[model samples]
Target: MRDYLIAFLTTGAITFVLSWIVWKVAIRYRLHPEIRERDVHKTPTPRLGGIAMFFGLVAFFLISTQLPGFAIVWEQPIRMWALLAAAALMVVVGVADDLWDLDWMIKLGAQFAAAWIVVGIGGIQILFLPFGSQVVVSSWLSISLSILAIVIVMNAVNFIDGLDGLVAGVCLIANAVFFAYSALLARDFDNSPETNTAVFITVVLLGVCAGFLPFNWNPAKMFMGDAGALLLGLMMASSAIVVTGNLPPQLLADNDQFGRSQLIGAYIPMILPIVVVLLPLLDFGLAVIRRTAKGRSPFSPDRQHMHHRMLDMGHTDRNAVFVFYAWTAVVSLSVLLMYIGTTAGWPGLYLPGLAYLLIGGVACVLVTLPPSRRAARVASDTKASS
Candidate 1:
């Protein structure tokens, strides 16, 4: 934990300094592109913040080399180095798209390529299902599914990069939850040095996101742009892959049947990662379907993203970002608590976590839609204007 804290503080310091430098350089050079009609912000903001994040990631990698308990993690250094390579590939592709708005086809190709770098070069495929006695799959199936999952998550995260601070904040919260899971896994579940690998990367992610948020907040000085968002998604997917792939067999077989419900303590490790990105995946799936139905490219840009809808439904920019934060926190924390309870063999946490999930979800839905609130505001505005 002390080592992890050092990594976090180191990453935060480096990322913060780099973000400031990048933002200033971008501003001085007027590197931002002209604003588009559908864009929310009036001024062109620098989108090169991802450059700082990439470098900060590099710093974390450097520090990781010296950290204790990493011998198990670094036994085959290729995988970790390959992860860095994949991130560099993503950052380059992302930077190009950020500057020139590269064709969606090109960006998609790079995304797949990045995933390949991780899976093929890194040799980090999802070894087996992390639950129900660790159901193993064929090698080809593992690589294919791992690559596909990486691509899906990368795009899902990128798709939600519509609001300032939205991606950074939501990811920060999501990683915070996963970081806790990994930490507990290290100290409790298996007590293997290997679990610390997940702890290491997640805290690094948490730190970078924490550092990046101040610059990314509403009325922003800069945006992480596509590169930062994609980089984030890739790391997130990779971290989950690392944890599940390396965990000891029989560690996750809490339930024989993977039932569908909120109190899914046995499946939380697998489910929580997916749930953290649930909103992004939902928005991604909906957008692809919506665009395909209209015979348009799935990556076509529009003003109808979830964040945009939140705005159209009367959420202020910060409020909308907050709503995303709220949803992420509620879902991720609920699952984390359930896992803690189940693993600790404490009083049952199923009902309590379920209650929180239901209540928080209902509140999120109300705040998200709020039809009467919108209508009343409309009426009030019309009356005031008249």
Candidate 2:
């Protein structure tokens, strides 16, 4: 834990400091693009903030390799290099797309190339699903599944990067929950949690998000654009892949220590990953469906995102972003608690997690919908504008 803290602090410091430098450089050189018709913000803002995060990620990884506690992670040099290479590739592609608005096919091709590097070069492919029993997969299926997951997550994260601080805040909360879950798994399930790579990855994610959020908040000075958002998703997916490889599905399923483990434990490993990115995935699915229904490309941009809907519900931009943060926290923390409860043989925490989900969900809906009159006015205004 102590070593992980060091890693987190160093990463946060680097990202935070570098973010300021990037903001200044971008402002001085007028690096922002023209404001789009659908954009909520009136003024152009720098979108190269992800460059700082990219550097911070690289800096932290290089420094950690030299640290004693991170020795185990570096033992397999190929995986780390692959992770870095894939991330850098995404950064390059993202920067180009952000600047030139590259065609969807070109961006997608880059995404596939990066995924292949991670799977083929880094060997971070998923070997099995952590179901009740290990559902082993063939090598071809493993590589295919891993690449698809990476690409899906990358796009999902990018799709929801509309509002100021939306991606950074949601991802920050998601990584915090994942880090807790990963840390617990490393601490209890593994002999030496100190050198565990998954925990290291999660903390680094949390740190970078934390550092970047200050500049990305409402009334933003900088945006992560495609570069930062894609980079974040790729790293997160890679971490998820590697963590699943370390998990013992059988241990998670067993009722040896506790009287019960069937309800949540058997599937929590798979569930938790999906839960963390639930909001992003929801938005991505909705956009694809909505676009395809209109006979347009799924990758086409529009103002009909979940956040845009929240605006239609009469939410201020800041309030809408907060709603996203809250939903992500409620869902992620609930599952994370369940994971701890089942793993620690504490039936008490597990049961309460269900209650937490119910209550938090209700609260989220209440916060999401405006009063009857407000909703009517918002509807009227939206119709007038359309």
Candidate 3:
């Protein structure tokens, strides 16, 4: 626990410092692109923020190796090296896209390459079909599924990067939830090297997002561009792959505390990468459908994103971002609580269900309220009086 905390702080601190430096360099060189019609920011903002985040991730990994508790991670050099190489590939693709506006085909190919490195070289791939089912898949199937998961998550995150602080905030919440789940598994079910790796990856990811949030928040000083967004998505996917693909079902089956049915349900926490990313996936699907119906390419840029719709509905920029944040938090925490209940039988399932109702109700009310009704009325009265 102490090592995790140290790793988190170390990574965050380094990222924060590097972000500041990168912002200065970008500003000096005028590295930001011209604002496009679909963009939210009126002014040009520097990008390449991913450079800082990548360094932060690498720094933390090195620091973790020095820590006595985390030193064992280095023993499995292939997984560590594979993850690092994949992340480096993502950073290169992202930087090129940010600077040169690389073709979508090139970016897609890079994503596939990164996914291959993770599955083929790192040896991380989904093996089990479901929790209770004894169905095991072929190596080819596992590899294909792992690559598919990585690509889906990468694009899902990229799509949701439409709003300031949106992707960072959502990823932060998701990684935190997964980190907690992994930590719990390590403490309770399995203390194996695999679980430890998951915990380490998640902790580092949480730090990366948290550190980058300040610079990427509303009225932003800089954008993460494709570099940071894709890198974040890759890390999140990698953590999920490590946790879900590596942790064997036999561990849960061996535990006498859960029945067969309950054990099946317990797989919810294990599959959190899919569950927690529900919003982004939904938005991505909607965007694809909306685009296809109009005879546009699925990757065609547009202003119909969920955040854009919020702006269209007259919500302030900050409010729109916060609304999405609240939605993500509610969904992630609800899933987490329900998973806990299923695993430990402590909190009731109704807790998360009720939380959903409460959060959704509040969000609806907030979104529907007129922005600064009192202020608008005051201005009108003042004009008349004058």
Candidate 4:
């Protein structure tokens, strides 16, 4: 408890102070995000908020390692160093894009490099396979799987950072939940060093996001831009991989009766990440499908995201961001309840969370008809000008 408090306060303070400094730099450099024809923001806004987040993460880890309660936990600092290295790479790539507007292919190549740095060099890969039988993936397969997961998570988060404070807010909540799970896992599993590392990273991430959220909220002073968003996504994904990758095999065993059903149950925790981040992944998928169908690049920007639909439904920017925030909270809380209810001897609550996903996903679809479909003539005119 004491260690968690120290981590939270330390990281939060570092992130807040650094973010303020970055905001000032953004103003000084006039690094503003322009309101394009398809943009939802009515005014230009400064970017490079990610630079501050990067500093916050670096500073927090540096300071926390020296604290009495954190010293033992920080003993194996190689993993942390690897995370920092990956973040630094992403930050540079993101900053370059924000300033110079790099092409999509170049940005993507950098993302792959960032993921590989951690998976290949950092040695953060899930080896154990629990599907009614115990197995470990080959080194090559693990490397490929880790890189793919990290890249997907990194891009999903970047793509979701469209609205004010959305990514930061969602990340804070997600990390908080992950922190709880880490602590719970730590409490449940005694023979693993990964638990402490997982908790430490998640808490630091939570603090980093908390520090950035105030600056990122509605009527924002500056955007995290690609740099902040990509770094954040990478950090979150990296933490998830570390935490679950180290789980004990017995804990992952499937509980069902059917041969295949039991196998699937064992993979639940491994699969939960994709499910947890389904919104962003689904949104990205839809965006690609929509763009490819029209012979346009998927990277093309437009006001056709989940947040944009909220805006079309008469939500102000703040309201729209908040609405999304509320949805994320509900989904997260529902999942928590389901996890608790099922584990603590009650199985009824799981349905509610699954139901919510179906309802919310359908609502998002019904409301967010593509801008091309809903306002085709207007879209054609807008594209013509662009």
lDDT of each: 0.83, 0.86, 0.81, 0.75
Candidate 1 TM-score to native: 0.91
Winner on lDDT (1 vs 3): 1
Mind giving the per-residue lDDT tens digits that candidate 3 earns over 202-318? 889888888989999887888888888888888788888777676665656555544434544546645566767877888889998999999987878899998888788778888
User: Which has the greatest lDDT?
Assistant: 2
- Encode model 1's per-residue lDDT on 330-375: one tens digit a residue: 9988887777666655565466677788999988876776566867
TM-score-sorted candidate list, best first: 2, 1, 3, 4
Q: Model 1: number of clashes?
A: 0
Separately for all candidates shown, the number of backbone clashes (residues 3 or more apart, or on different chains) is 0, 0, 0, 0
**Model 2 Cα lDDT, one tens digit per residue, 245-332:** 5455565555464226675655787788888999999999999999999999999999999988888877889999999999999999
Cα lDDT of model 3 overall?
0.81
Q: How should the candidates be ordered by lDDT, best one leading?
A: 2, 1, 3, 4
- Clash-forming residue pairs, model 2: none
Give the number of the best model, judged by TM-score: 2
The per-residue C-alpha lDDT of model 4 at residue 80 equals 76
Per-model RMSD to reference: 4.1, 4.7, 4.5, 7.2
> TM per model?
0.91, 0.93, 0.90, 0.85
Worst 10 residues of 2 by lDDT: 186-195
Q: Which wins on lDDT, candidate 3 or candidate 4?
A: 3
